[model samples]
Structures are given as structure tokens and as C-alpha cells.
Target: MKKRLKLNLQSRLQIKTVPSIRLANFIELPEKEFSRFIEAVENNPLFLKLANPLTPEERVIIPQKFPGTRFSPHCFLSLDEARLADASPINLSPVLERHHKAIKLIRKLGLDKFQKYFIERTSAVLPEDIARILRLKKSQVEAINELMNEVSIHSEFYARSSLGTGHKISYIKVAKIEFDKDKNPGITFFSPRHFIGRYKIDYEKVEQLKKRDFFLSEDIGKLNALFGKLELINRRKNILYQTILGIIEKQKIFFVSGNKDDMVCCLQKEIAHKLSVHPSLVCRAIYGKSLELPRGEEKPIKDFFLPKKEYIKRVILTLFKEHKKVLSDNQTAVELKKTFGISASRRAVSNYRRELNFPSSRKK
Candidate 1:
């Protein structure tokens, strides 16, 4: 007969928002052994074959199932997000509303031209590339000397984002738990759990990080290349302002002429789904953020889209963009429905103005 010794103990080790053993992406370090890192990430069964792998699939997420209960306590999070989410919660209605309005204003202002101009500063486009893309005069392209002083694109404002909805992630995490070994050989485990982090990230720096490279990356070139792809992150706090304003600008079509019924239904979830991101991402992007409009008005970005229609948006922006001193939504809606086939009602229009998040509107 064979006897076994058993030690039953439950010890909980809490990891805060960070501790990434994962290798850096763009900027490489002398201390970090790249070959070993590749081997670990590639999971080459032979270990030495990381240098020469037969399969194209290098980093694979293997899924597993634990049929039952979890034993240990783990507060796992995407370290970066937790840091951002820690420093800023998306729940700040005031900030979100303001951001929404400011972005709306900025879009009305056409900041993309600014972004485009900024990029034109860093990278040059041969006449061939521009000919394939846009139709313009040779002198006009040459005049872009004003646009591209550096003879290249600077990548200051292209960012990837969509509206988002909150949801749970589906990655497998195993936490072995107490089980009866007399009947079962393998211990029970827990996975896919969500927990809050102990520390917070600096959004101020995260914002600063837009123009700058992340502190830890495998290749600076790759990081810079990633920067060129992502214009959202910028060197200034104002860029966050610009981004929200940009989101507002992009969604201007739905806001101005469309109502709750004809409205494009810009649900955060729908936008998130379109962009293939988690809702918390949308939440984070929109949180603790506000804007100062021209009228000395301040509000959160969330207030802009939570309502059903964009009719008020069209009226207000048209008035401001086209430079009309005062135009009523009733008048605007009538013109839109009659001329452009836009759907809006007068009462609904007033409600829309009220939704613009103007504090004085509360008096109405």
C-alpha cells in the first residue's frame, strides 16, 4: 500500500494593476534577452526552435475549462487600463458631457485639417501617391511645403476608437481550488473573474504618452511606427480634448439632423462592436473628461449621445459653423425636414437644446 502526505492551505496573493512579464513590444532593452522572450511567447515545444519556427502562429492564447469552483483570490486587470481607469473613472457625468460638447464644437471646427496638416509635416507624399489618393493641382501640392516642413508626416492625431459598451472578457485564468482527491485526481480551478486594482495610472502622463513612446517597448522604431498608426495619443492634455471633440465631429451627421427615431442609434455598445473593443475602453476614453465651449459653457461628453436625437446638434452647429447669430431649432428642423428630409419635431427640438447640457437651459 502507498500512503501520501497532504498539505491543505489557502494563501491569497494579490497582484495590483501591474506586473507584466509579457515582453515589451517596440522598444528593446539590453537586459531583456530577446531570444528567450521569443521562445516563451512563441511556445515552441522544442524551446530552441524559437529562432526557427515552422508555424506562422507565434503567440497563441490557449483556452481551457475548469468545470467547477475557484480557490485563490486574484485581481487581474490589463495593467495599463487599470492605471488609466484608476486615475480616471468614466463615471464623471460632468466631464463626459463637457467633452461631448467640446468635441462637437471641434468637429464643427474641422480639426482633422489640423491633424492632416500635422501629419503632412512629418511624411512627404510623392506626386504618385497623392495622385492615387486625391485630385489636386501640382502647385497646390507643392504649396504643401507649408504643410510638410519636415518632408514627412508627424502623426499627431490619428487615433483608433469607437463608442463602447461594458462587457466581460473571455480569456481563461486558472486558480486551483480545494477538491477531494480521494475521488478526483486534479484540483478544481477558477477563471475569468474581474477585480478592482489597488493602484491607479496617471492619465496626465497617459495623455502625455501620445506623442512620446511608451516607457517599455522592444523596438523604438516599431513604437514610432505604431505612433504613426495611432494619432489619438498626443503630447498635450489638450489632445484628449481634441479627441473627444473629434468623436463628436465624426458623429455630427447623426446629431444635427437625425432625431430619436431617424437617429443613427449611436449606442456606445454599437460603436464598440464596430471597433472590436471592450465597453470599458469606451468608458475609460470618455471618463473624467470635460470641455470649455466658446460660450463659457462646460459639460461632460456623455451627455451628447445618451439622448436619442441629433437634431439639436445640427441646428446649433449649423448656426455656429455657418455663422448665424441666433436660429431656433423649430426653424432649423422645419428647414431640414422640408429640404433635406430630416426628421424632427419642435417640442423635441426644445428638448434637444435642453440636452445640450447648458446650465441655463435648466431654467427653461
Candidate 2:
């Protein structure tokens, strides 16, 4: 009878679990409010910070504090207690430490001026030369340059907050370019947890709360809410990444046809349909995000999702350049189908050509 009661309680708790708030709404929040929200989440009592440093792969664990049957109201373990409980403390990555130091040095030396100097220079500038100009040590310059190169390739997302007259910027690694064994480029995404670390659940404390008849349901519901948001964000990001990869693979011919103007058409609705998600979710995932290409160009995530008509126009222009001679609408339409496997009516081709302001066959 006791075991049956316990099972019934567990089922009730599972059934009463509340859903998490929408990640889209959280992302679409204003900058100041968003920062505050992040601060609140990070400062929650359930999340205990680690005094000891953490390795890249290590996560902090919330230790059990009260061992006896009697449970204190303050059941959660303190930071000191957690540290003491941990037998093996992991050290932070040296590379990550150096990167942080470099960012600080750059901020102190004036980021605006440094960027201006680089932009004004016509030729490639060396780190030593930059250091000489900025009155910084060669090593410092080299470290700063290394961090800058990483940002240019991996693209860190910076959140800014007002600090008196000046502003303070904190960076988080969002996405990075990864290569396969074949040397083909792909994308790897990192969640906020990757940069800010997370605390493991204290199951002992949870069990105690339940035994004490404390309102564990409310706390569980809150946690479930957070989990829901994180899960949704991760799912949407994965779908978006896979959709982009699929587009690149299917449109290889468009990419390699020596047409610099031609770009992959990745509409949000189309991607959502292919991935079985809402278009609004895709928009939220892409909002305020930038991706860095292998060639060091940083473009907004939305730029990848060009309108279908724009892509078609670029292809038509490419076709015109390839032919090297004036072609009538009928001829252009035929060539598009034969060469690029794109079928368009002659009348539609004529409309697109006029829209591009290209001269007619007679005018040429």
C-alpha cells in the first residue's frame, strides 16, 4: 500500500509539470530587458557557482549538504561546501584564459582606434607594426590579433551593458565553422551553457523536500520551464543548421558555375516546412545573429535567407554574362532550362530582364 501511494504521487507530479515559456519571446525582448533576464536566471539560488575553475568538458555538481534524516529549511549546499565535497577540482583551459586576457588588453587599448587603424591601412599590417603604433608589447599585440582572428572565423556574439559613461561588452561563443574529413566546411553551434557553465541538480535535496512535504512541485515546474526554453532553442538551431547544409549540397551547381552573384536561396518558410517547424521560430533563431564565413566576412544570419525572386534574378544575370551575346527572352528561357535545369516561361524571363534594367536584344 505504501509503495502504491509513492507511485501515485510520482505520476501526479509528472502529470502536473508545467511547460516552459517561449524562447522566441525571450529572444525578441529588448536589449536591456534581455540582459536583466539573463542575470536573473544566472543568479537563481538553485544555480551554485564553482569557486574552483572548470575544464572545458567539466560541469559543476551541486553537492549534498544534509546527510541526516532531519532536513533543514536551507537544504541547498553552499559554494564552500560544494568545493569541499568535490575531490578532484579541474582547472580552466589555459587557451581560454589567455583569450580572456587578450580581450581585456584590447578593450583597455581602445577597440575603436584599433579598428580604425586596421581599416585605413591599404596593405596587410603585421602584429608587430600594430603594437609599435599602439605602444603595446609585441606579445600583447600577437595575443590580441589571435583573438581577433578567432572572432573573425568563429563569430562571437557580444552583449553590451551601460557602465557609467562607457559601456561594457561581454562575448559568448555562439557558432563556429567546422570541417569534415573531406575538408568540406560545416557549422557547429554552442549554447549559452558552453560559455557560462551550469550546476547539476541536487537530487538529495529534491528528495528531502518531497519527503518534508515542501512545495517541490513549484520548484520543479520552474526548472521544467527553463529546460523547455533551452530544448527549443537547441532544436531550432539544429534544424536551421541542417537546412543550410542541405541547401548547399543540393545547389552545388549554382555555387560553382562561376557566378559570383548567384547565392543559395534559403527562405524561412521553406526551411520551416522542410524541417517541420513554425516560420516564426526560425525567425527568432536567426534574429540578431551573425555568421562568419571562411574568408573572414561576417554576415547577418538573415542574409542567407534571400528571397527566391532575387536568386532567380541573379541566375538570369549569370546566364546573360555566360552567353556573351544578346539573347532574346525565348532563347534565354531555353538556355536556363538546358544549362541550369531552371524552367521559366519566356514572358516571365522578359519581365525579370526588364526589372534588372538590362537592354533588350534589339537595343544591344
Candidate 3:
């Protein structure tokens, strides 16, 4: 290999977030000489006001409790144990029961209803669909499902989501969703562990009584559901991010890949739809959001989300939708090149097409 010539020497700018500084320099100076200098130089009213003379509340060092040699009880005893002395009598059995109930309900009811409940709190189904699934009268299903919702009223929990992390957990409770579009439709009961007639309890009042030693067992349930919601949200976010990033990764070979990826092209709407979520939610995942990897670094979960190449996906989708015949990569490439002003060859088109999951337009 030939030796490379040296380029220009330059220094990169380093942004200092915080460096050393003194309180005396910021506020009142310890020395009179410095105070006089501040008074003379800072002519602006705000600065002058902030200087020695014209200020209203003069900075005074309040006498702090002198660092005593004597140790407090907390120093010798465990803080948690000390606090527990003042805490309410806790019956953990209730909390554990509520937790298990929530888990059982999700497992028994099936993921569809549980997932629906997680998101919207209610999912409507027609009478016939209900009958087909549950083998019950539409009326019975509606009553049963509505009864489940009443049994698991959690909308109230979401109303107070701004509380502490624990409190916020209490705010988004999970309940089995039950709705009948007809006069009465079949309802779903997910939890296999039925303490009472196919229900963890007959009603919320009875259920809420099992306080789990907390303010309300309902809140405890909410807390548990919130964890599941957060996990699901994280998973969805990662999947969306990966898809966007993956497209960009493969787009470099678009010329050779477009015609080969019909199924991949079908996912454009899916990817584009996710990028539009509130940005704060997106960043929320980035800060300390992590998962246990097979490699075990516990990498941030946000790394899964990636920016996708929107333009390329749009082109692929358009080509797939427009092409009626089962055209092979060469024919599809010709059509795309001729009509779309996209300069790509048959092989490249084939690769891209396969990636997009677009079925080949060729006759079977």
C-alpha cells in the first residue's frame, strides 16, 4: 500500500457542560475590592440590582446545624426497618393475590382481549361473531362482558397518571375488555383462576376490598397492568425502529433488491404510521430503556428503533400496487425504470422486490 499524505491539523470544539465555579464569584464576593469592581462594571439595572447595594433580599448565611459528632438512630439501624415501624399494618397476601389475579386473568382470557383491554379498555364485537366464538346468546354475552367491565373498572386509574412512578402505575389498571355491539353479545373470561363464578370476584367493590395492604387493590392491579403496557409499548417501538433501520440498511442495494421484496414493500404503511407518535414518548424510551440481550450487556431497548428510508419504501409499494400481472424481476424492473424514472436493473429490482415481500407478477 502507498503512504497517505498528512492532512490539515485541527482541534475539535469540546462543549463543557459544567466546569468549576465559586459561589462568591456568582453572588456576593467575600472581598470588598471585588464587590466595588462589580458595582462599577455592571451598569445594567438588573445587574446593578443584583450587586451589593440595591437588592431587596440580601444573601445571608443561615446558621446550619453544626456537623455534630453524635450519630442518629438511622446510622445504627436500617432505614427501611425504622420506617416500617411507622407504616400501616401490611397484609402482603392481598397484594400478592391481586398480582396473581391480574396475571391469571391475562393468561386465561387470551391475549386478544387482554391486549385490547390494555389499550382501549373496550372492544366491540357483533352478535354473530360473539355467538360463533362463545356459543352463548347475544344477550347473555353482552350482560356477562359488561359485568366483566364493571367487575374490572380501571378507567378511573388512568385518570390520575401524573402521580409518582408507583402512583402512576396505580393509574393505568388492566381489566378484561367486554363489549357487545348487539342487545347482548358473548363476553370473554380470560383468567383461568376463577375464585367465583368465572370471575376473580363478583364485582369491583368486593374485589377492591382485597387492599393488598395498599390504598386500593384496584390500584395494585393497575400497577401490574402498567408494567405489561410499558413492556408491550417498548416491544412495538423496537420493532418499528428496527424495520425503519433495516430498510435503510437494505436500501443501498435497492437497485438489485426492489423487485425481489414484495412482502417487505407491504410494510410501508406499518413503518410510516409509527414514526408519527408523540416525540416525547419516543425519547421516553431512549432514557434508561434497556433489555437483557443474549450477549448480556443489557443494551438500551430504544436502539431497536431506527429511522427508515421513506422514499424508497413508497416507490416499492407503488410499483407492487400498480403492477397487475405476475411480472418477473426483469419485467418489473423494466416497468419501474420506464415509468417511475428509477434507474435500476433486473437483478437489483429482484432483490429489492423480494425484500419488500411483493409477490412476483409472473404467471404461476
Candidate 4:
């Protein structure tokens, strides 16, 4: 017989919300369960290679089958059952009772569904209609309508967010240069130097725990201490912020308007010095992160720190003009290597020629 062992968690279990193909796209699964599944998948290399990987949603959700059933013990619902449980009719009145209860309801419905429910239900009922239906005073109905409007706005905001709704950004756009006495400092341009946002912390719930009878004074003290520690962890900014800011500050002219001519050679040590940080720290900060640009394009942050490769394409174009005819890929590669000491393969030369809209040498 196989032994079934249940792992007891002493600390809080972090839940994962992943995107799904199902109608309920925001699938919340236990961290342990998801980790175990991932491990199982990793064991089968062939299956992993063939399988379509799961993508994570921008929003995080705590899904439950019904109200007051959070950490919902078990989830064994059929697809048909899930499709049938419409969120529009679930008792949303409980949500208005308390802030935490509202959060719970939002979690239960998932952000997408809850927003849909709110929009559909509220749009169908005016304040007067709600007063008549729910037998509430006009003032109460007005309040409810106000809250629903806020919910709708937040929903639309999250839906349109780029770089995931999880990442909140505060940016500072400053002029690239100050006017010099002799130099032609005529044009003023703006560029984003720093990006930041406050960490989300649920302090209201911590304060609410005082009302529970089971929570003794000592427990409250311990909880406060735990919150303090948690706050410290959450409050610390991402180390990469300073590095990115340094890069932007140093390479302001190039980044400000995406003009390649304005670009100057920049090194990681230069950025580190600008930010008063170590060179390794600068490297680590920009390793995997991408910077969102003003033109709705995103480029790897590290790309900006490296030497620009556009010059190679320019040189190839110049060579073609001088030759007064398209050059063969091999011919171009040999010329680049021999004349400029540039190591370019025939394939790379071919690609550059194609990018420049020149016919292949054979076609010419």
C-alpha cells in the first residue's frame, strides 16, 4: 500500500492565480498542488516539450465555489456546473456589509466575473428601480450606485492595463538637457527617468482582527509584530528601479525620442556610478526586465546599455551605394570583414540587404 502524507503548513500558503482556457479563466490553485503538478510535468521532458504551457493572468484572485467557503476545502466541479453558476444573481448585498466581505465577494467571483456581474446588474437597475426592488431608502440606493460606478471604473482600468495589472508604475519625465552658454541647447525633450509605485498592504484587515473573541491580547501583539515584519518586506522597492533610472538619466537624449543618432556609448559601470551602486547590482537589475516605451513598444533594458548594432546596417547600405549595384551576400560579408574588420556572415549580410529593400545579388 502507498503511504499518503499530508504536508502541514506552519505558515500561510500562497495561492496562485493562472490564466485558463475555460470560461472561468482565473483559476486559483494551491501553491503546493501547482508545484507538485509542475514537478510531475518536469519529470516528463517529452510531454513538457509538446504541451501548451499555462500563462499567468495580470490579476490575482482567491476563487471559491460559494460564499464563506474560502480555502474552499475541495474543488471538484464539472464544466457544465461551472458554466451554469451565473455570478449576476449571487447575493452581492453581503459585499456592501463590510469592506472585507466585499473583498471576499470579489475574490469569489474573480475580478473579471465580479466586474461583469456588477456592470450587468447595476446597468439594468437605476437607483429608483433598486430602491423599489430592494426596498431601500433613496439615499442607500444612491450610495450603492456610487459604489458600483467605482467598481466599473476599476474593472475597465485593470482590463486595459499593460505589463500586467499587478505592476503599478509612477513615472517622471524630465528634460534631456539644460541650456549651455555656448552649445546649441535649443530643443527641450522629456524622458522617463524613474518608475515606482507603493506596495499593496492590507492593514485594514489586521486592524479588524481585534474584534475576534478567540484573539487574545498576546495574539494581537504577535500579529502586530508579524505585520510589522511583513510590511518591511513589502515596503522595500525593487533594486532594479535605481539601475533603470541611472540608465535613463545617462542616455536621456537617445531614450527621450528613440533617435539612434543621439545615442552614446554607455557602460554598466557608468550607470552604477550614476546611481552610487555596484556594477554587478546594475547587471542584476536589468537582466530580465524590459522597459515599456512611449511608442507602445517594449525593449529589453539591457539592450540600451549595449553598443547599438544599427551602424552595421548603415555601413552595408553605404557599401551598396558605393558599388552602384546590389552585392552578393558572400561579397558583402567579405568586404565587411576585410575593409571594416567586422565579423559578419553571409546570412547576416543577406538579412541586412533584404531589410534595406535591396534585391538579392543573384536577382540583380
Candidate 5:
């Protein structure tokens, strides 16, 4: 018989394990590298050629099993049980149908344009007249008008409650600072409160309808799906706020110096740690996302997380521009250590200088 190595349960339990190769690679990639990977996967001809075709039925997968159970469907009845009990499938609620129709109309009109038209009309204007003006059916217009009325009420309430605070009160429009051609710019902070208000409105509507015996079982499922969307939006909004805060906290000197060329660096790992999530999840959450800054400039979210090497290069460039006397690699490295708390070898500084196309001190 061949000799076999044996381990005690406690020894086996204490053995170290590593994450999967794919997850480890994802977590290790720098912001630029990860962005390039995403771009290649999305747009590269070779990857596109390798993509598998999807079937019509496989286009969307619907979950049939009930939550926390393995076998029971959401209907809670097997086909045999339903047949024995002579139970019928639940019908959609009329209220939910009307809500869907209004959503369809809103999509066609565009949310911003719809809101503009709605606000432009005076209080005296009737729903019927508004329907005629927009070339929409009267019922659809009524439904949308009702939803907007609730939104306006909620907006007013939040404005009053959140006054003098940093909290945002609206989410429908992208908040951006508008600058005059020759004047100071005004800032409008982004807020996601409208998502909560809309969710509350739907919840109240569903409750009222259920109390009146108007909602079918299927309507609850539909409403739950809608609520899930609102929750997702709220989660993304929080992640974005957290990422920005992390950047600001990590680059205090950059913001305080007020110099555009002042280099700032924020790593995804730091943000992931702050948010108590895996770095790969943070990367996935922000990939391909862009936001409008306070100064009216739009930038990719990943641009905020700079690699250590690139950030050091920018710092060296800024140092060169600030000082009139040309400094040798050793001197630059010393300045980096003294000013930015960064310790770089003279050789490394020389390499960075070369990469930045800056002349050496002797050449200068």
C-alpha cells in the first residue's frame, strides 16, 4: 500500500486558501488596465466573433421558484395541485395596466420634455386639454398627470425638510453647475430623493388598491419588480457618492492647492475597503459610468482612480513647472519625499522624467 499523508481536522481547518484566479486578477488590475480590458471585451473584433448567439426564449430568464425555496413556484401551487383545486391564474390589475400605459407615454415624450410641458401648463388647464395638446389618449394623460402631482408634492416636502443641509432633494434631472459667459458659476448638487418619493407613491397606491380589493396577486409581483428597480438605483447612487468622497478624502492637498495640474490619486482598493465590499465589485459598479462634475465637465468615473505610477509622474511634472531652476533626479526625488511624503529612488525618478519627456538638469 502506498503511504498517504494525513492531516488532523484542526490542521486542515487552519490551511490558507486563495481566491479564484479570475477574481484575483480582477482585483489586482489597475484602473486604466481594467478599463482597457472592458473596452477590448466590448469592441474588439476577435471577442465579437467569439460571442454566442442567444435564443429567443433565452433572451430573458424569469425566476419561477419562490424565494428561499427550491421547488415551489411563485404561484405556490404545483400543476397537479392547481388542477385538483381548479385554481386559475391571477389577472393583472387595471391600476397597474394604466400605470404601464402612462410609463409608455412618458418614454415616448422623454421625461425632461414631459416635465417641461407639464410645468408650462397653468393650473386651470384640464387633463383633457393637455391630452389633446400632446396628442395622447385622455386616460394615459390622466395617469401621468396623477403621478406628476404626487412627485411635485413630494418634491416640495423634501425641499422644506432638507433646507440648509447638504442632502439632495431631486433625482430626475442631472444636477450641474451652470456658468454664465462672464460671471461666477452657480452650483446645483445632485440628489436621489426623487427615487424614494416615487417608490413611496407606488407603495401607497398599491396599499390603497389592495385595501379596496382591486389588486390581483400578479399585481404584487409586478410592483415588487418595480420596487427592485428603485432599490438598485438607490444603491448605485450611494456607491457613486462614496467613491467621490473617498477621492476627496485621499487627495486633500490637490483640492486645497486649487491647481488643475496638481496630481491626485485614489485607489479602488481603498474605496472598496471603505465601502466594505470586494474591489472587483467596486470596479464593476463604476465601469463605463460617467458623471457631470460641479464645473459642468463630464468625466469617466474610473478616471478618478489613478495608478500610483501615473500619479507620481504628474507630481514630478508639476514640480518641474513650479521651480525655475532645473533639478537633477536626486533633487526631484528629495522634493517628492519632502513635499508629498513619497519616497522614490533617483533611478526611478530618472525613468519617470524620461517617460514624461522632461529634459535632465544638465540638458536644461
Candidate 6:
């Protein structure tokens, strides 16, 4: 009962896609296309016969399936005569072909290819694991890393609910810190703006295309796929933002002084819970993603994972410096739990102390 219809025509054409800003589903074709397609069917006898319009008061004749029976051609016009009275130019061959090709190419390839294409275009890799997955030659990866070194986007200072309304709100001033040509560090903040691609498309322009007389029928379905893909990319970018903001909000002291020592332990699960997403999603978002910090540097999101051994070392060092006597590793473990909330086994504490040449007990 359904088959492809072949039509040959020549006309200037362009494609427009309408997608919801908040949702990643559905694409709708403009009304003008429907009107034009109706006109095209009227002008072509073959298509008109296939459409099979029925007349009022005309008795329906069911066609016989017996061989050698011939039936009169039939045509249908769902739209009223008044609606089709307005003549519209309908040409869809070119537009349908283009949309079909693009959709076909997208479906034929996997996400990895597209990810690599974007990475190549944006040069936006930061995590070592992502680099390994990219499988780029060592030279190519290093070359891209060193090629373009400049601040691309800028952001403004702002404040939010401090991650919890109960907690005091905090102001954020992101600055690009770079040393002057003479080697003196200078701080600069860029104009505040939403990150690019968040809401770049103008729906009004797409609406304007509705006034046209015709569009490709395939465009609706094809563009839906295209827009869905675009929305996914936007989602990834959003995840990166959420990840960074959550980290900065939780570990305020580290970013304040720009010192690793100030970094408190931040777990991936903690961030995932705060963002209300899966821990695996948080991991995927941070994989190969880096945020351009106010310090005019790019840092991997994974760097927020406080190194356990290093943290233990710092905690032990603090305990040793503040105490008058060397405490047993067991005592050190207990003190670590009490003071820094770090749970460390006695053997682990002893090994770290011995590795650092700190005696098991303080010099009496």
C-alpha cells in the first residue's frame, strides 16, 4: 500500500529546521510545504491518481483483485478547494536529496568518528585517557596541543545560590591570569556571556521560512535526527559546566589561592549526587574535558580528585608539625580521622611515614 514516488523537477530550494530549545525531540515542517505539495499533486496526473480523491454522493467502487481487471484512475484532495485555490510553487527533488544524503552519512558512522572530528576542529582534549582513546599519533596530538594558544571565549562575574540556599551565597569572579611579555603576572576578566552553542540558534529566523511556498517532505524526519545530535553535543557541554561549577563551589579554598595544598578531597560520586546524575555520567563528562579557568589556564576536571596518598602525606605532616612528640602510626591514623576526617589504616600510615623518613614515633 506504500511505495516511493519518483518525481523529477528543478527549483531553487533551502532547508530550515525547527527544534525546541528545551527538548531534544521532534522536528516539524513548515505549513507552506503542505500547501505546495497539494498543488504539485494536482498538476501531475500520475500522483493525482495515486492520491485518489473521492467525490461527495459518488458511490465507492471496490476494485477487484482478479487478474485482467482494469480500473479508472483515482485522485484525492484532502484539502478543501478554497485552500488549494491559492497557487503555490512546489519543487522538492533537490531538498529531499540533500537531506537524505546528510542523514544517511550520519547514520552510517558511529559517535566516535564525530567526536574525533569535533576534537580535531576544537582541539579540546584534556584527559590522558581520552587522548589514548583518540588514537592520534603522538606528533599530531602534541602539535595540535601547541598550535593554537589563546583565550577563545570570555565569561562575566556572577553569583548563585552557593549550591544550597541555606548556605551563604558566594560571588564568582573568573579572570584570565597571564604573565605580561615582561614576565609579570596580570589578571583579566572577560565579558560575561553564556557559553557559545548554548542558545545560538534564532527560532524567529526558522519561523520566517514558513511564509515560503514549498519544502522537502523528507526534511522533517531528517532534520529531527540532525537536531537531536546537536542537542546531545550541547548536553555534553552542559555536563562539563555543571561538573566544574560543582567542584569550584565545593572546594572553594583551592581555587581561591590557586594552590594544590588547599584542595580538599572531592569524590566523583559526591559531584554526581550533587548534580543528580549518575556517577558514570559525571566520569564521561569529565573525560577529556577541561575548563578555561580564571587563571588563564586549562585544567582537566579529573584534577579535582584529591590524590589520596598526597593528602595523607600532608595530613600526617601537619599532625607531626603541630605535635611535640612523634605519635605511633596507629595514633596518627586515629588523629587523621579525628582532625581531617580521613580514614587511613595503621599500616598505610606507617608505610607513608617510613617512606618520608619520618620516624614511627616522634623523637623524644
lDDT of 4 by residue, 1-364 (tens): 0221111121002110111122021112221232233334323432221121121111111111111111111110111223223432233333334333333434454544433233333122334554555455666655543444332222111112133334444211211222234432221211111111112333453354345342455555555444332222221112344444455555667655776545555678875554444466556445434554544455566766754346577778778888988889999999988987888888888888888899998898
RMSD of 3: 26.8
Candidate 3 lDDT, 65-174, residue by residue in tens: 11111111111111122333332234323332434433343445454553343322222234345445645456554444333333232222111112224321222111
What is candidate 6's lDDT per residue for 61-139, written digit by digit as tens?
A: 1111111111110101111223223331233233324344332332343444433432222223333333465664544
Q: Which wins on TM-score, candidate 1 or candidate 2?
A: 2
Q: 164 in model 2: Cα distance from truth in Å?
A: 23
For residues 181-289, what per-residue lDDT tens digits would candidate 1 score against the true structure?
4422222222111011011123354345444543334443343333331211111111122234334444444333434233333455543443333344444444433
TM-score between candidate 1 and the true structure: 0.24
Write down the worst ten-residue block by lDDT for model 5. Answer: 65-74
- Best candidate, TM-score: 2
Q: List clashing residue pairs in candidate 4.
A: none
RMSD score of candidate 2 (Å): 18.3
Cα RMSD of predicted structure 5: 21.4
Model 4's C-alpha root-mean-square deviation from the true structure amounts to 19.8
Q: What tens digits encode model 2's per-residue C-alpha lDDT throughout 160-245?
A: 11121331322232444444455454444332222222233444654555565543455656655554533333343344454445
Native-to-model Cα distance after best TM-score fit, residue 127 in candidate 1, in Å: 38
Worst 10 residues of 4 by lDDT: 67-76
For each candidate, the alpha-carbon lDDT, in order, equals 0.31, 0.47, 0.32, 0.40, 0.46, 0.41
TM-score of each: 0.24, 0.50, 0.20, 0.29, 0.43, 0.40
Q: Going through the candidates in order, what is the number of backbone clashes in each?
A: 34, 0, 47, 0, 0, 7
